[model samples]
Target: MSAPANYPIESVENAARVLLMLRDRRDLRVADVAVELGIARSSAHRMLTTLQSQGLLQQKPTRVYAAGPQLVQIGVAVIGATDLRAVARPTLERLRRHLGETVHLIILDGSTIVFLDGVEGTFAIRAAERTGDRAPAHPSAAGKVLLASLTREQLRERYPSSRLRGGTTAAKKSRRMLEDELEIVRSQGHAVNLGESEIGLHALAVPVRDSAGNARAAISVSGPSVRLTEDKLTEHVPVLLQAADQLGASLS
Candidate 1:
């Protein structure tokens, strides 16, 4: 038989509840937390500050608490480690077949984009597989799509400086430029890399969102710019979005 329930520690339970609350709501102030938890404002502030100290939460400019990088990283790591690749592989393969280009499953790790898995196209001049590869997030379609999911404060936290760096000259030169591009990605629900990661490469990506409407990963198609021209990349958006939705549903 399974273990029976024991006496619950109230503080620990409250802490867990706070985390759970943050998971659903984007922001919380001390008063909001106190009222919801039926605790004093001082108690709520103490709890929030403690979690912030442990890197489980962050305080925004508006003095509201948001999920911190450590919390997000832990969630992303779990998604990447367990069901993500296995669940996404079939969808990626089907997308590759449909698009006739390399398809990659990517997740954000701070300012980096890690290629968790990929299905390489059969064409002789296709983009290479990038499974287990890490690239600068600012210069890749998959990276930008994932980045666009973050709040403006989160983006600023990730990139504090104006100057940026990447492997290719076409990469966004500053945080301002990157934020602008991310805004476009957010508005369009997709991102594109036209020779931004490499001189002759082009790619397009859409977000694989979880039930909470947060991006857990990105699905991308990449090929040589000669074949995947700007117009062609635009043409692939609808199908890519379909694949992302399929993958997101499976993950959920």
Candidate 2:
């Protein structure tokens, strides 16, 4: 199809605008681009086509667009592949031994949790069968602890009050309940998961703050409640807290 009359010329200035628009969104559809710039759909399509051909934009299965592999490759170089795993390995081992359960180092990526690394205990039965998994912020142990570090405004932006959904059927929490839980988290400087993410899984987590005192990630211990009794969790709290304190001591 031909470019629409409303399309800005294929000049360096307009190309710069194209990059800016893409930079602002993780995903954009053809219609969204047209509406944002007051351009016709055909014009936006042509621009997207050119960008895709040149390896700047990628079209998903649903035809929504995101930054292409080229940009991801560039991002890899710029982000320097920081090895948080290496930095926290010894700490995780110590925490796992103290808790006698699986310990996780999870990073908050956007409103979701990314399990960057995990150390499974020697126990025969464990709750989380996943490593390198991702989960929503409101439900998971590490996720909530990290979420609690953010401000109420940030929580609203990430998990809006209107769309709040409780965790698993066993441990359902409404928006107000979650807000209350967050307040508790802020007060204790730790978060608890009582079969919220999964049935029979009990977890406790503390924020792994940086040298700047900002919670960048969380360290969590999860296990089967039978072995991971309430008393066990209470006993392990100080251990987890101290380990997190050590992890934050170096990274500014």
TM-scores of the models, in the given order?
Answer: 0.69, 0.66
Which one is best on lDDT? 1
- Candidate 1, 62-110: lDDT as tens digits: 8998777577556647755547877898999999888889999898988
Task: Name the regions of candidate 1 deviating beyond 4 angstroms.
Answer: 1-80
What's model 1's lDDT at 115? 75
lDDT, model 1, position 140: 93
The candidate maximizing TM-score is 1
Q: Give the runs in model 2 whose Cα sits over 4 Å from its true position.
A: 1-81
**Residue lDDT tens for model 2, 83-169:** 666688889888777666899888786677766667888688875434345576788778888988888788778766555654687
Alpha-carbon local distance difference test for all models: 0.86, 0.75
